[model samples]
Target: MKDQGLSYRLTAGLEGYLDPADALVTALAHGGGADNERCLKRVTAHLKADVKEVSAFLGLVRIRELPRREDIELRNTAFLHELGPSLTGAEITGLYTELVRRTREAMQGRLGPRWAEQLAVHDLPTKLLRKRIGPSTVADLQQRLLRPDHVLLTDVSQRLSGVETALVRKLRRGAATDDVIQEAQMVRAHADIHRMKQQSLGTWPADPAIEADLDERLLLVARRTIRSHATDPRPANAIFDGLQTTLETSAATHDRWPLYARDSVLLMGRACAISDECRFDWGTAHESPA
Candidate 1:
């Protein structure tokens, strides 16, 4: 199992080098006599696309784009040569077939027929060096839980959802002063614009830690509202109303957010749900017969 795993890792690392090499080679093969220059130029452009696609795939698979060590390549070559011949031809073909499919899909709707022809790749010898390796179970799960592979996701989610809590706290301390209200308004406006920027940059799927923190904060705010305004239910009700409003607006705005920001919207939904549930529980407890 360990040897098989190492083989897979070696193949994954080799894939980046072989991807563009194979594209250029295939184009050269078709170049033949007359169209060599034109084919080379076309292949050059195709190579750029190939590099981009391959880089994205590598990132997705969490493999380094380029390894600095020289001996690694030699070792990989020796290992593959030693191991390649014994492997059945069918296994080799299946590997390349899957690679092509994955490459096209990773391009994310950009892989058209022209691109398919320009790359013009088929089963190559190096295809045996192409293997799909994924992170360990814990690492993979961690990645899925986090926000779009960014550390700032936690801060952003907190900042965005903090608006309502900030407002409630300000109101609870005393009457809703102009300065307090203005501060809350400013925070909300800033959060809205920040969200739009994140959407534009395709930074969807907020980190789970960030979302979890926001949910807890929102719930805390709801509980505080109940405690702080036991005599006047209006403020607590308003806080719940604000949570609902934010949730609805966030969902509607997601239609305009980038494809990558889909996870962020879900985070918003989860945060709102926590707030809503907290509010409902408070209301039910207050109304219970004594």
Candidate 2:
């Protein structure tokens, strides 16, 4: 059930920023090569992102690019709010210290304390470990999605395997030539369109023709988005930047260690192992569950 819940969230998050069919196509289109790098390159998020922008933004690349010129103060305040609602100073320090110490020890033979300290300056928790992930995260994600240079190389690695699987399915079923074309069209149509990013258009899709046009637009939108990020990736980059971002500041003030997470979450219905002796010891000590 927890797996299903995570799966459900994943599906929702994908739809929120990705074009499903186009992503599949991109995955199919870019998954394989003589070299076999990543699903796509540019959109991939290599650092501390909850959503991997590199291979993931593949389907939504076709949207119109609107320049964002927001007021600096308002934008800064919002960013802080979004990222500030999790973790505490001390806990952040603890995690950072542990991560750095472990990393240094692991690499001591190769790089020594000097290089390790340099690396430690950037060590922080990955996106998955954070207590808060929201619009600020999304905004950062959008940066990678839009830029050819901002990709996370490692994020696309996992998708290569999936692409192989998807390609087989498509080829086996004899899927049509128009299918990829249709998907591409969808990607281009809305690859960059956003309701929130608008300058306020009233009743924008004003005609029946436009309504139908929107439906037809889906495939192109998929193409534009996917193609931009169409590079296979490495897997370790997201955590790297995520950890580094934390060094700039502590975890959000609201950050609390969750009871469950991908790496450390305790699952539902795992039996607590309390032996009779332990129970008797606890009773003798007059200890209660804290």
Candidate 3:
């Protein structure tokens, strides 16, 4: 569930920064074989910023970029929370030493000689095990790191995936002359069906369908905003950036992880699916009326 939850959060994070159809069209219009790369770059930048903010809220410091490893502060805090204040120095030290030995052996067995050897010297727990820090703190850290991958929960991934699949199918069935609004409505309808399927599976949350009818609305807004800006000579890039910023700013207002996580995943994932399906359609990219 945590894995799914994380996937959901990632989807939400993406929604904050991405305008699926706009991103796709802009990238293709760039005409340099940089469509995917360019679009992803923008998305990645936004995701990283959100991740950094989230990590900071969770008490991680000194992160220059999104880290793959658990922060020492997090590990220490979790450890202390799990183990009470009754630990003695000898008991803590003993536990740390044993854990280090076991961890090294496990790493060595799984990762081969070089990594095991590298970890033997460089691992945080290994180093901390030898330190004369407070016993309660070390003892606490010991227990916490033993368990891994704690996270919030959500079931948006599968739902989002279903929406994606249906979106692609819908787009592939579409005509070149199809209005963007019409396509948006079709995509939103398919997303609704997927939402119902998720609900039927009982994996979806009991929460209101915050995502319902949003695809049509986002597309409509995008069409209007982009068209409204068309009078500018450099309208294309401005429209794309403006729409993206608007979504990102709106998503950031979620303030809390769960709300942002579920809403974002739903918003971005469906938006992206629609965009991906229609990227080459060129019909989804509406020009300003002359």
Candidate 4:
């Protein structure tokens, strides 16, 4: 039974890695030439790698399928000037496949595509993506940024919905805590953006102080999410579920004050005295859920 379960998980991972479109694009990418060699090399490398279980192998392949981009959301931010030429059908299909497959992974507690988008333009400075848009919207062009995986997903920006999850499974215990926190922040940001956009408020007070307060509170929650993965580690999906709950509650109490007020940040400043221990210690954080 354990063997069968492992096999099932492995196959699921492959489904994500070998998305039809990805395979198609890969095929076209080689144009029946060196690309084939590259694919073969990757497969050989995989075989030789010290992959313990089928799930590990499949997970690696899925990670490899993930698209790497400097700027996030090219279709939404910048798609006009010159980044790359038009994508062929194979290219388009490949991206779409990767995106959906990843989103599915996120659904299973990996953190999703929104996390990917967040990593692209978060407040943190890192080597992942380093292009700034000069305090302006790029609007789906390939100028300074490009859409991840070339998918037409201008709807929700939760790109890391599949992989932002903080987990020991993803790495050993020595992984950078800051990186996990940043990824969680990205997930929270996407959720907040979706809520704000759905409401379509023209001006909701973009005060730096207010935004910073909100971001901090969300960051705490995001950190908690990462911590969850540290334990039994159902962190990503758990955080996402908790996010949905918070959003619904906030939307309901958005107009109220104190008891349920607009000025109240859900997890932000003055909301709860969430100290360092509260942020990371699930036991302490949950002890007083009043």
Off by over 4 Å in 4: 1-201, 243-290
Give each model a TM-score.
0.21, 0.15, 0.23, 0.23
RMSD for each of the candidates: 23.3, 26.9, 23.4, 22.2
Misplaced by over 4 Å in model 3 are 1-210, 233-235, 252-269, 277-290
Position 226, candidate 4: lDDT: 50
lDDT, each prediction: 0.40, 0.29, 0.42, 0.37
lDDT of 3 by residue, 124-175 (tens): 4544443324556356554543345443223322333342332333333332
Residue 187 Cα positional deviation in candidate 2, in Å, after optimal superposition = 6.2
RMSD (CA, angstroms), candidate 2:
26.9
For residues 1-290, could you state the per-residue lDDT of candidate 4 as single tens digits?
A: 55676442221111112223356444533332123545545654766754233223333332223322321332211222112226544454455455445545544543345767766564644322223332232343233235454544332234334332222112222232455445445443443443444334445554446545554555555565556544333333444445435645564333322222343343322222222212232221122134
lDDT of 2 by residue, 80-187 (tens): 222332434444344445544544554444443465454555553342124334556346434423345333434233444442222222212222244432332332
Lowest lDDT block of 10, candidate 3: 9-18
Candidate 1's error at 110, in angstroms? Answer: 43
Better of 2 and 4 by lDDT: 4
* lDDT for predicted candidate 2 compared with the true structure: 0.29
Show how many residue pairs clash in every candidate, following the order shown. Answer: 6, 60, 4, 37
Report the poorest 10 consecutive residues by lDDT, candidate 1.
Answer: 9-18
Question: lDDT of model 1 at residue 283?
Answer: 33
- Give candidate 4's whole-model lDDT: 0.37
